[model samples]
Target: MTDGNPDSDGLVVAAFGNRGRLETAEGETLPYLLKGRRLKAVCGDRVQWKQPPQSHEALITDILSRENALQRFDPKGRVEIIAANLTQLMVVLAPTPEPDLFLADRFLCAATLMDCNPVVVCNKTDLQHNDALRAALDEYRQLGYVVVQTCAEPGGNVADLTSLLTGHTSMLVGQSGVGKSSLINALVGDAAAAVGALSDASAEGKHTTSATIMHRLADGTRLIDSPGVREFVPNISASSEVQLGFPEIVALADRCRFANCQHLREPDCAVKQATADGDLSPRRYASYKRMKNITASGSV
Candidate 1:
C-alpha cells in the first residue's frame, strides 16, 4: 500500500478540498492527501509526495514552485487559486445563459494578467444566434483576441478547439450553464466517468462537484476543467495594473495627457476619448473601470 521510494515528484491532476489525485512521473495516477494544513494544491501543480506507511494514499509533502496561477478573490476577500501553470485560458460563451459579456471580459482580463493566452470560445453554436451576441463577439475579434465558435453536440466544431489545445495546459472558465462541461465531454470522451473513478479511488466522491480536474489529451495537451461560477472577481493586487489586462486601453494609455492617468475624469485621456469616438468598445471600458474600482476598494 506504500510506494517504495521515500520521495517522488508528481503532477496534481485533481483537487477536492484537501484531498485529491496525483499522477506520478511514470504516469500512474494515485489518490493524494495533504501532509499539513498550510500546503494547498490545485490542479496543474507540480508537487513532491510519498506514500505513508500503512496508508493507500500518497501524502503531498510540498508544492513545487508554479510558473503562474489563475486566482480570484473569494467572498471573504481571500485569494483562491483555481489552477496553476496554465498556458491558455479559454473563456467560454454561448447563445444561452444571456452571455455575460462583462464576465467574459473579466476572465479575459485575468488571463492576460496571469500571463496566459486568452481564448474566446463561443460554445453552443448549433443554437440560435442573435445580432447583439454576434456584435459582441465581433468586438472581441476586433480587439485582437482569438475567438473560436464551438458546439458540444454530435458533429460539433470541437476539432477547432482541439487543435488550439494541442501542446498546452489550458483551463476552461466561464459563467454557470455556459456548456463548459459539454465542451469537456466533446473534447475528451468519458471525462466525467474518469473523474468519478478518480474520486471513488480517492475516497472523496462528494467533492467532485467542486473539484478541479485535469484531463490529458493524446497530443500532450492538458486541459483543466474548473467549476463554473456565477460571479468571479480576479485578484488584482493594484488598481493601476488593471489596465494591463485590457490591451486596447494599454495601447491608448501612452496618448493620455497625464502620465499616470486612471482614465476616469482625467483631462484628455485617450482611453476615454477612444470610447467617446467609438474607437474602443464602451462595455469593455466600463468593465475596466469597474474592476479598477473593486481593486481600489480592497474588497470584492
Candidate 2:
C-alpha cells in the first residue's frame, strides 16, 4: 500500500461508508479508510492520503478541491452528494419498470445545473418498444440532447455509448430495473466481479450494494455506477435558477414581459406563449412547472 513514501495522492474508486478503494497516482489500488468522521468522500474524488504506520490500508487525510459535484435530495429532503468532478452523466432508461420521464427530466436538470453533459441512454432495446417512450426520447433528441439506444444483454449494441464515454468521467443513473448493472458488466467485463471482491474484502457487501463504484475503461475513461432509485429530485437551491435547467425555457425567458417572470400566470410570458404556439414541448413545460413548484416549496 506504500511506496516507502509517507503520503501520496489518490483517486477514490469505490466509496462505502468510510472504507473504500483508492487508486494511487502510480495506478496501484489500495484499500482506504477516512482519517476523520467529518471527512466524507465519494467516487471520483481526488484525495491526499498516506499509509498509516503498522497498518496495511491507506488513510485519506484531505479531499482536494472539486470542479463540481452532482447532488440530489434524499428521502429526508437533505442534499446528498452523489459524485464529484463528473464530466458526463448518462441517464439510463428502459422499457421495463415504466419510463419516468419526470424523473429523467430531474436527472437531466441536475446534470445541467452541475455543468455536466447529459446523455439519455435507452437500454433494453430488444424488449418490446413502447411508442410513448419512443416519442419521449424523440422529444429529448429534438431538444438537442443526445439519445443512444442500447441493449445491455450479451453481445448487445453499446458501441455508441462506449464512444460517448471515451475520455470522460461519466456516471450512470436511472430507475431500478433499467439494466444499469448489465450495462456496467457489458461495458467493463470484470466490473461486477471487482465490485463483489472489494465489497467482500471490506465486509460491506450489503452496504456496498447501494454504494457508488467507479470503473476504469481500457481507453482511460472513468465510469461511476450509482444505485438505481425510485425517484430523484435535484437539489435546486432557488426557484429562479430552475429555468436554467431547461434550455428551451432559458432561450425564451429573455423575451418575457417581466424581466423576472416565473412563467406562471405572468402575462406575455414568452415561455407560455411558446407552449401555446406549439413552439415548445407542452410536456416539458409542465415538467418545468412541477420542478419550479418543488423548488419554491423546498420539498419533493
Candidate 3:
C-alpha cells in the first residue's frame, strides 16, 4: 500500500481513527489507510495517496499544507486538532443540559485566533429561553458574533440559518444536547446525522455524532459535524496568543499602560478597566482570565 505509481490528489471527507475517506480530483471516493504514524488526516485536508499493485485500500502518502486548523488540548495536555481548512466555526448551544458559556467562549476564541468567522447558533428554541442562555446570546451579539435562535426539530427560521451556511466550510461544534445533528438534518434536507433525544432523568441529549464527517449542501457548501464534548480548551502556545483570541480585548489593548499587558493584575489595564466599567461582559473577561491562566501554566 505504501509503494509508488498509483497516485492521486484527494480531499479528506471523513476521518475515523487512523483511516479516512478521500475523494479524488476525478471524483472517486476511496478508503485510504495512512502510510505511517506521522501522517494524521482530518476532514477537509488535501492529501496525496498511492496504491500498491494488489492493495485493497489507498495509502495516504502525504498530507498537503493546511491554511488553518481548529485545535485544543486533550485532558492529558496533548494537542487535539478539531478540523482543518475551515472558514467558519459554528458553536451550537441551547437551553437544556445547561449551556456552558465558558466552552462557547473557548470556541469563539479559537475562531478569532484562526481568523475564521465564529457563529453562535442557539438551537432547541422550542424550549423556553432561559435567562442564562438569553444573556449569553445577547453578549455574543454585542461582541459582534452572529447569534441565531433556531428550532431544528420543528424547522423554525431554518431558512435564516441556511443562508449563513452557504458558500463556506462550516463546522457544528458544542456539547451533546445542543441539537447540532438536528440542525444538520434540517440544513442538508436529509437524515444524515443521527439525532438523539434527551434522557428523562439526565435531561441531556445523548451523543449521536460519533465521528467527524463532512457533508455538502446542494449549493456546494461543506459542513462538518464534530463529536459532542463536555469541556474544551483551545491550544495556545503563549500567553500573548490568549488576548488575540478576544476581539474586545484586542480592541482595547492599545489603551493599556504596558504594551505587553496580560490583562491580569497589570496597572492601567484597559481590559480590566472595561470589565470594571461594565463595558465588557464580566463572564467573557473571566473566561479570558481563566484561559490566560491555562496558557500561562503551560498545561490544561
Candidate 4:
C-alpha cells in the first residue's frame, strides 16, 4: 500500500484496485491507498510519488498540471471530472442492443465542442451482416470522420482502430456490451478490462467497467476507458451549437428565413425547405429538433 507524503515523487492512480495488484505505468502493477480528503485523483491524472526507505511501494505527493478535463453531472447531479487530458474520444457502439444514433451524436457533439477528435467505432461485426451498417457508417466517413468496425472475438479487425489511437491520449466511451471491454483488451493486448454479457431478456448490457482507467498501449498510445454511459444527455449545447454539431445543417442555415431562425418554425426557413426537398435525412432533422427543444427548455 502507498502513503501520500509531501516528499513523494510519482503519480497516484488506481486501476482495477483490489487492495492488492493495480495496473500502473510500463505494465507495472502496484499497491495503493487513498490519502487525505483533498487528494482526490481520478484516472489519467499525473502526480508525484516516491518509494519509502525500506519499502517497495511508493507514496504519491502532488498532482501535476492537466491540459483539459471533461466534466459531467454525476448521478447525484453534482459535477465530476470523467477523464483528464483526453485528446480524443472513441464512441463505440454495437448492433446487439441496437445502435443508438442519438447517443452517438450527443457524444460526438460533446467531443467536438471540447476540441477533441471523435472516432466512431462499431464493434461485434462478426455477429451480424453489414449491408445497412455499412451504409450508416458511410455517412460519417463522408463527413470526414474516421469510423472503424471490429469483431473482438478471437481475431477481429482492430488494426484500423489501433492505427488511429497510436501516440495519442484518447478515451473510449459508449453504452455497455458494445464490445468496449473487448476493444480495450485488443488495443492494450490483454484482458485489462472485464467483459460482461448482455442481458438476454432485455438485450441490455451488464455494466462491467466500474471506473475510469488509463491504459498505455505498446505503440506509446494512452487511452482512458471510462464507465459505459447508458444515457448521454449532451450538456451546454445551445441552438446554434446544436446546428454546429451537424456540419451540413450549419452549412445551409444561412439561407434560412431569418438570421435568428432556428430552422424549426420559420416562414422562409431554408433548412425546412431543404428537408422538404429531401436534401437532409428526416431522422437527422428529428434529432436536431429534439436537441433544439431540450436547449430551449433551458435544462441541459
Runs of candidate 4 exceeding 4 Å displacement = 1-36, 49-65, 130-132, 191-207, 237-239, 295-300
Top lDDT prediction, candidate number: 2
Please give the CA lDDT of all the candidate structures: 0.86, 0.88, 0.83, 0.69
Candidate 2 residues lying further than 4 Å off, grouped into runs, are 1-6, 195-209
TM-score of every prediction relative to native: 0.92, 0.92, 0.90, 0.78
Per-model tally of clashing residue pairs: 0, 0, 0, 4
Comparing 1 and 2 by lDDT, which wins?
A: 2
Instruction: Give the Å shift of residue 35 in candidate 2.
Output: 1.1
Per-residue C-alpha lDDT of model 2 across residues 1-300, encoded as one tens digit per residue: 447675688999988889999999988889999998999999999999998779999999999999999987777878888889999999999999899998899999999999999999999999997999999999999888999999999989999999899899999999876987778889988777875554422354232346788898877789888887877878888888888878899999999999999999999999999999999999999999999887766566
Full ranking by TM-score: 2, 1, 3, 4
C-alpha-based local distance difference test score of model 4: 0.69
Residues 1-300, model 1: lDDT tens digits? 155565899999988778999999988899999988999999999999987779999999999999999998888888899899999999999988888887888899899998999999999999998988899999899889999999999888898898899889999998766777678878887576774454322254333335678988766579887777777888888888999989899999999999999999999999999999999988899999888887776554
lDDT of 3 by residue, 125-176 (tens): 8889888889888888988899988888864667767889889999999998
Q: Candidate 2's C-alpha lDDT?
A: 0.88
Q: What is every candidate's alpha-carbon RMSD to the true fold? A: 3.8, 3.5, 3.3, 4.8
